[model samples]
Target chain A: MLEIKEIWKTFNAGTVNEKQALRGVSLTLNEGDFCTVIGGNGAGKSTMLNAVAGTWAVDQGTISIGGTDVTHLPEHKRAAFIGRVFQDPMMGTAPTMQIIENLALAARRGQRRGLRWGLAKAEKDRYQELLSGLGLGLEDRLTSKVGLLSGGQRQALTLLMASLKKPKLLLLDEHTAALDPKTAAKVLELSDKIVAENHLTTMMVTHNMKDAIQHGNRLIMMYDGRIVIDVSGEEKKKLTVPQLLELFSKVSGSDEADDKLLLS
Target chain B: MTVFLNALPGAVSQGLVWGIMAIGVYLTYKILDIADLTVDGSFCTGGAVFVMLFAGGANVWTAMLAALLAGMLAGLVSGLLNAACGIPAILCGILTQLGLYSVNMAIMDFKASVAINVTQADTLEKLLVSLRFVQGSVKGDFPLWRHPILVVGLFTACLIGVLYAFFGTELGSALRATGSNGNMARAQGINTDFCKVLGLMLSNGLVALSGALLCQYNGANEINVGRGAIVIGLAAVIIGDVLFSKLFRNFALKLLAVVIGAIIYYIVLQAVLAMGLNPNYLKLLSALVVAVFLSLPYWKGRYFAKPVKRGGAANA
Candidate 1:
């Protein structure tokens, strides 16, 4: 359950480098909705996610999650209701910290940190169980610094951390874009399983059209600064690559989608 | 050899005193991932606050507490400048350190330096630890607990124990996370600004306490006492990290290593002085030693270590 209304953001206004990143964009996601967002280069897809995450305040418009307006809330304050995974795996976890410590931090999201011991014994057991569920053998090395983990491992760990506290809205900004196809697929599968199991409302951005189509219940295509195509239910399942491109051409009237949009 | 032997006790006691300050340095330099320059000013602020308070008839304990508070306030200013005003951490600390020079002078009643009336009945009897006690404990003029080494060693142990416990707490972990990865900390809903401020406060509090002890031991608080203090602090932290980082993985032991590093640093200084090195070159020597140690890891990794392919899912 998340809502965005009339969001507009322009970077470096009235200068040579000025670019309108987001222009009057609005979208709403119902509970348990898993939406895959697809767009070519500079489609404002990631910008939309960052806006919801409150990385920077939008020049105009409001965003609300679970019936609370977070338009003016700082990024960290907005973190109370949102879980985020960045494109860079390094961005989601402290590399020098232990795996269990990272999970422990996630577990206490939206809660005040007091003088209590950081990681409880019971939490360690629970974290091991969670790690085992990933089937990555991370349960055996809970104390190892996250810096030693491979990027894929870090990404998987970040995915687990994001949903550890069951955020009201999960935001994935090209979360698996950097991984190899096999690892990306595995991570995507894990994402689906985790989101489905938790009934999490999620918005995932991907450049690959197939992932945009093959995953999630709803699909939206962005061109320029606005969502131009919205498909879901039977229609979303029936959509294909050429058909989606045709719709993008019909709406945005730009053929810039040829190379950047992955047909496979 | 005789000169070295005669100075060993004083050197050891002075080392123990500075070890507490090194622990304070470690909090910012290692834990918070900040090379805070504010300690240079706050160190004297502690001595100035303590000496002025003690001279005005306050008990040593109360004066020490006041000094600790003064140091925390200095850290608070630096933290606000860095975190709130968006100044860089180094610049914020430098500004605070520069401003504190005048503040330290004012605290000494516009004098560049001040002394404890060690001859006065109140100042002498109310004192906690002093350099005189270093030889006094040997002659049984005072109890062993009054010895500078013993008193400061106990003080260092207590500081380390409290820091070890504090860092094990949830709030402390949050602060560590903030320094480790700000993005992750914020995503975890940690108020990173608050954590940075709290850490600076904690760090400067210890630094000031060390300064209070230093002034008491030396019998005077001078304006230049804290000059280049950051270099010494860095020397202790880097030395400990270089020598004991692998052997001392536990947090408490790492702190102990830092104190041990300070002792070793002072012993070397004393040895160099005894070996006919000009005393004025000590700061330069300290800076060079720290610089070399700081670059050792980087140079080893950059020039000697093998590069590996990064980012494979199979590696997971």
Candidate 2:
């Protein structure tokens, strides 16, 4: 469903603060695959997802979504086939806009916008039905400005918006990191339900080891701008934190996994 | 008291004319989330276009339309500088405004000022608005259309109505979304650059129209007519926002608040003049008022803020 070929991105190149975010990283996802990505800080997991999302032009790479190369497309143009939920809750939606309006915007994702009315009477009813599915009571507040919503509600709304038009690839960038535990669990569950129902190809970045292991059909660990270990299906189901650490230590040729990775 | 009363009608009419320009500022400042200084020049460009075209024996409406288009062209330059050339929005507007001084001069036949030939044999009957008509209407000898308050008031209402509807449409919503959140708008494939450019065009078009009307009312277009125009517009917007934000919940009513704010501003200016203040100091007074109003919200949030109490008293 998505392909990344030897992508490379360097920030502040030729400067004192130069840092290479991605280096010759390549990965491909099969159709209907829900992949969970994990890494320590600066592991390039998020950078890899951004590369595929076309947040900026990678110094070197070719990325394709559903067999169409989109590496050269600008961020907004590439949005035609990509759905993104950012790490910051505020980045995913317009705060000053209303719930129905936000959904209506997402409904036109990948489509040309014209002089038609932004919100049709029928669209409100449909958004209400979709919001009720989240069980957040959002349907009751369709016209309320999105800024008034709690973080979880907003993320859930963002999730709904991202999947409104069924993009070819959905990118979730630590979407639940800022939420309270209960709310994070609720949002994660909502993400799972939406992706499953839509049969969407998804790449979800997470900080929690348990979550990375528990959700998704496959899991990949990134370290120093490269994928160190990838486990899937039967192997992924049997994987435990300690075993995963041992595998990471072996594959990364490191003495041991860092405490931050274990603790997180 | 007599001086103040005598200035009231003139203040109201001037306020109504400036109110239109303030509405244009509201689009960029409040809607597009930009403070476009381009109006400082485009306002004069509007007057220059109107006066120059009307003097060339064109129809009055044609002159007005040309003025609107000229203002929009000025906006297009600023918008491209900001969006396409990668300059900051404020800087882009400043650049366009600076360049427009020369452009406006050229448009006015390289003259620093120009006037409508109302005294000419063929001109006075074609004027859409004028101070003479305003005086005639006050004496109850002219038609209702000749009243500045009525003519400009009706025009403002129509402009507001059209804006209110336009903002509710898909393209308009995309523009609003772009202003509110560019990142999210792009994620939705909104082509926000196009929206920004279009918004500037729409905003400056209205500003030029306001300028055209002001020129007609004053019977002259001076190069300095647009001086401090941005401050006045910002003052109107901030005043309207501070005063009527809570009372006016509807979009159209909010726009009306801006117009009312301009009227209040002009009425206050009239009072200051009645009190014997120098006319040249009026711009200084407007700047101070805007500065104070702009800082009010920040001051309230910082100085008078209540502590955020937690659920438990101990947590507070």
Candidate 3:
């Protein structure tokens, strides 16, 4: 459902800080494919996802969602076909806005906002039902500001918002990294449930190798600026942390793996 | 004390007139989370547009509408500079404000100021609100209903009512979201740049409306009328937020708080002057007061923040 062709992005192009963030990287995901991405720091994992999200114009690339070329589309325009959950919990929702208001905003994605009342009476019941499904009791606090919710709750809410309208693609950029283990596990489980329920095409960036193996129908490992390992279906299901580290060591030509990636 | 009492009605009327401008400032400052310095020049743009059009024999409403449109244009320039050109927000506002000086001068035919000949009966009768109405009402020359206080009070109420409704709309909610979280807004498919421009237009439009009213009230539009206007706007918004944020939880009430804040600001100014302070030092005093109030929240965060054990699934 999503197509990316040989994308290249360089930061600070000519200056001393110049770094090629993405170098001829390319990938394609089929409809209903939930892909987990793993990479060490500066692996260009987030950079690749950002390239697909149109955070900035790629130096050279072509991206298409559902056969529509959106290579030059601005971030907000690309939003019509994409849902994104940022790493920072605060980045995914407006703190001062109410719970229902944030949901309403997500529900109206790809639609023109007009002079009509922001929260429709008919949608309130639907949102309440959806919130209740999360088991967070957010249904009772429709008018409460999202800022009052805890990190996990906010992350859960953001997950709901991202999949609210079932976009062509959903991008999760290490969404639960900030939370404690238990909460992160809960949010990850929630992500699985939501993706299955919605049959969403999702790309989830994760630091945990075990998680990269455990979840998703497909898994891809990024190293240095390109995808060096791609595993799917039965192969992905049988993948283990040790095997993945072995693959990484083989691909990176190093005896020592990235400490942060291994520890996480 | 008696002198202060005698000036109280005029002070209140002036406050009500400025209260409209404060509401405009509230839109950008509070709602949009932008300190748009465009008001410094747009205020006079409104006055200049209104007075020139009114002098040219346009209806008062038409003149006011022109003034509002002029102000919106000024806001558009600043919005484009900031959003499209990617200039810093403060710098964009400053650039627009600086450019507006010449625009205001040109609007007044290169003159520094323009005065309405209120001595003429037609002109006097045509004005919506004026200082003469304030004094005349006190001496019973005009009815209380015709007083500038009553006239401008109605204007403020209607303005707040309109704003309250607008902010509740889908477009308005998106605008608020843009201010609250631009990244979130964009992810949700909101054109945040468009929202920012619309907000600036709306904000400067109201500011111009207030300026036009001020010109009518004072019987003149001076080039320096808008000098320090942003400070006063900020003063009113901060004062309102400090005093009434807790008491007024509703959107409409928050706007009313801003108006009342302006009134309180004017009342305090009158009291200080009554105590023999020189009028020449008024701007300096206003600057200091606003500076202190602006620093208050930062001080609280830096000096008084409590350490809290934060994070985890338990809180969630």
Candidate 4:
């Protein structure tokens, strides 16, 4: 479960190019909740996820993850409770390292790193089993450098790495945006399967309105640094893109959606 | 042929020292993905610190340790500049290097140059003189060589072995990952800033250790000893990468290749000099060599690989 209280974040505060990324935004997620977030460009969706991840200090806010106050924690310190898959596939994994090594790193997350030999037999077997679950045949290529993998495969590997330690919260920030349509569909399916099987509390941000409706138990829409709509349970399951669009237009008081978000 | 053989031992010995420095450079440049120029300053810092400590009655081991610590401090300064002040990594390195010049001078007892007089008291010199005396009494008129290159060569070999083992460890793997992708490392709960500082410190410490040994071997330490050292180290790394592409997967082999590359570089320089080349043009020659090696990767990637842009034709 996660709670964000009165979060406010401003970039380049008081400067000529100042932008208030998040303004008095607050949200909550119960245990095992999978929430899909939809927003236009600069809607603070990514900023909200980053705030949860502690990418930077919020100007004012209190964030609690599973009853632990983590708003003041540094990015690395908060990483034990937060697993993040970035928009860029390259941003989530080390390219030069082998697949098994990357998994080994993820498995040791939050533990004291030492000078011992990496990837003992048990760890390697555990990683192979986990990779096999992705159905990507990465289990057979434990020694293959991650750079040699396709974008989808790399993203899948990154997903596995992020979830290996079973963090308290998983953050997926447009994780499938960089992949081809088919690959994206496959990855999205895998994301659902993984989150469901692991009983993870996840926040997935996507520009696609259909995806927002099609997945997750809860759906939220944001505009101008605030959550405009939060739908869940029966209402979220029955929602359609048209209905969501109509709600966005009515709530934001704008018939015209941002071109980027609409086109995307 | 005999001249080449006679030069081989010295070349190999010096190459090992340069190899250590090159590997140090590779740590920051290739692994950490930062263009760290602190090596240039730390190398001289090492030499100055070593000589000063040794002259102040410290043993060789103690002097070497001092040099390593001094180099680490130099690297820490660079890391702090980049992290605390938001300066660019390269500029941070340059600032630290510039600051180290004065610090190194101060460390050398405010001297511009300090020459370790190896005429009599040096361990190697004493051993060599004793051997020569024995040879003189027995063989009479047989030439005797001073300063056994074998000891230095063995020491360097052991150092490389230790480094190879260390780099294969989990901590080393994490350090390497930090260089490959800092953000990913951080997302995985690795404190990348700490890793950067640790990597830079380790890198410059090794470089300074080499410089310390180099000064003792050469019998003198000048303020400018580290000038253009970064380029030389880069040249070694690039050349080593080119010649031993197959060995790149192994850290130790890559390091060994760097040692060979340095020796080959020196041999080429010596050969050019033997062919009546100007010794003063060493820097220019080094730059050209580095340029050629650096461009090889791009050249191969562009021309020799399958053409991605043009239909299915192989570009080469």
- What TM value does the first chain of each candidate achieve? 0.98, 0.98, 0.98, 0.97
In lDDT terms, which candidate is top?
3
lDDT of 1 by residue, B60-88 (tens): 89999999999999999999999899999
Q: What tens digits encode model 3's per-residue C-alpha lDDT throughout A1-264?
A: 999999999999999999998989989999999999998888899999999998899999899999999999999999999999989999999999999999999999989999999888999999999999998889999999999998989999999999999899999999989989998999999999999999999999999888888899999988889998999999999989889988888998886565646875
Q: How far is candidate 1 from the true structure (C-alpha RMSD, Å)?
A: 1.9
What is the lDDT for B305 in model 4?
82
Interface RMSD of 4: 3.0
- Candidate 4 docking category? medium
lDDT of 4 by residue, B134-200 (tens): 2343354434333324445566679788877776777777887898888899899888888888889
Deviation in Å, model 4, residue A260 alpha carbon: 5.6
In candidate 3 the C-alpha lDDT for residue A56 amounts to 92
Segments in model 1 whose C-alpha atoms lie over 4 Å from true places:
B120-122, B306-316
Cα displacement (Å) at residue A166, model 1: 1.2
TM, every model: 0.97, 0.97, 0.98, 0.93
- lDDT for A139 in candidate 3 is 93
Against the hidden true structure, what lDDT does model 3 obtain?
A: 0.93
Candidate 3 C-alpha error for residue A249, in Å:
1.2
RMSD of each: 1.9, 1.9, 1.7, 3.5
Question: Residue by residue across A88-183, what tens digits does model 2's lDDT show?
Answer: 999999998999999999999888888889889888888999999999889999989999888888999999999999999999999999998988
Question: Looking at every candidate separately, what fraction of the true A–B Cα contacts under 8 Å does it contain?
Answer: 0.85, 0.82, 0.88, 0.79
lDDT for each candidate structure: 0.91, 0.91, 0.93, 0.84
Worst 10 residues of 1 chain B by lDDT: B117-126
The list of candidate 3 runs beyond 4 A from truth reads: A258-260, B304-316
